[model samples]
Target: MNSKVVEEIKIKGGRVLTLVEGDITERNVDGIVNPANSYLQHGGGVAGTIVRKGGRIIQEESDKIGFVQVGSSAITSSGILPCKAIIHTVGPRMGEGYEDEKLSKAINSCLELGLRKGFKSMSIPAISSGIFGFPKDRCAKILVNETISFLKNLENSSTGIKLVEFCILGKDTLQAFQYEFEKSKPQS
Candidate 1:
């Protein structure tokens, strides 16, 4: 619960994008994205943390939904967590043929799903930067760029998403995302 917003910026449609350093599980958003595998296994990494804090209902719901494809996402109840829902997204492995594109698509999938689900705010972590073996810096850049592009294109659109937060955990991971967020600022 020690999460803190490192920085924030406004995108199109007056939406807010934030770089946060803390645990996603404690975020008080409408939804929190889980960087899951193809099988929706809640064994380790972010997925495990979500399950550990959120509860077994999350995994049970995931089992019912079965497998989710890479670059795609599935939704489930947040169990006892603060969020209403958890968006489980599958990011491609490091050796995958098209890692960058797949990661971008994964982020898009999470955002699109959140929009459709009427999520006004959501928190996401570095999708493929953990055990999936993706480079943290590249993952941060792609996540920030793709999310900004998607939000910018939603001008005048019927989008309910007003806030998108990158709730990173580790010091190194947080620094990576922070760097990307700062670099994204427009020149004064």
Candidate 2:
């Protein structure tokens, strides 16, 4: 769970968007978005780590909720974690038809849920970029662009979201996200 903010930028409406390298479970944002399966299993990957750090109650609550459709999201208590809630989102697996659109919807779903919950800050990971076999570069691009689109459209002046941190893991994933964010920066 070792963590640090590698880069940050002030987007439209003065929202502080950051690219963080570390475990999502350690972030102290208002909510942490988990890239989960449709059945909400927390047996491995980031989902497992979240349950391990946050507590089994996270999985128990997810089990209670049953299933979440792809490109959708469901909220659960953060358990022992610092965040107020855990937004579980289902991203598309590789080879799935319309993977790009589904991933976009999944990211958007997390943001919309976070907005509705009045979360001022949220930590999200590279959805479906792990065992699901999504190309990290593409996932990073989608994650960064979708978040920017949401913030610019809503404008933090009238929204509760003041910060959005991509709490990424692994060197490759971090690099990919960082590169995408760098590309998004406005020229001085």
Candidate 3:
């Protein structure tokens, strides 16, 4: 429950939220967010990794949400991904209007949902930049900004989330998040 200012940061990212190349099931964040399709079923991408590692229970729980429109959110158990919970978020597809803003909204909403549900740490991937189509750099910047914004606004949020990390998997995705994170770090 350390106090953190709602201020901008200048970061040198030696790490980031793992993306396509990172191991999704090995993370131990209080919760991990998933960029899921409306159906929540696993497929040939990040979603697939989740299902493969976490198990069918992940998709089954997600099915309870029905169909979450793009930019909206839901939450469920991680099944078997090593994370305690999974925040299922649906983001805008490529060329969707206001995609970046919607992506930020989706990302923040997922975190907010996790926090409200009593999680103290959250791990999120680069939203909307993969199959959804938003540019990786743009999504990373907005994702970090929106995450910071939410942290700043949450009352008594200190212990609520001591660590909010991005889990990037691919080299390009990793570089994108790291670059934006470093750019956003507060100058010492």
Model 1: residues with Cα > 4 Å off, grouped in runs: none
lDDT of 3: 0.72
lDDT of 1 by residue, 64-164 (tens): 99999999999999999999999999999999789999999999999999999999999999999999999999999999999898788777876678899
- The best candidate by lDDT is 1
lDDT of candidates 1 onward, in order: 0.93, 0.92, 0.72
Q: Which candidate, 1 or 2, has the higher lDDT?
A: 1
Q: How much lDDT does candidate 1 score?
A: 0.93
lDDT of 1 at 12: 66
lDDT string, candidate 2, 1-188, tens digits: 57989988788787878999988888888999999999999899999999999999999999999989999999999999989999999999999889999999999999999999999999999999998999999999998998988888877366679899999879999999889989998789
TM-score of candidate 3 on Cα atoms, chains taken together? 0.84
Per-residue lDDT over 1-188 for candidate 3, one digit per residue giving the tens place of the 0 to 100 score: 12212223422232222223355556777888888887777685777888888888888877777788777788888886767888888888887588777787788788778878888767777777888778888888888878766665654434466567777777787778777766666566
Better candidate number, 1 or 3, judged by TM-score: 1
Please list all clashing residue pairs in model 1, or write none if there are none.
none
Those runs of model 2 whose alpha carbons end farther than 4 Å from true positions after fitting are: none
Model 2 TM-score, all chains together:
0.97
* Model 3: lDDT of residue 9: 44
Q: Against the true structure, what is every candidate's RMSD?
A: 1.0, 1.0, 6.0
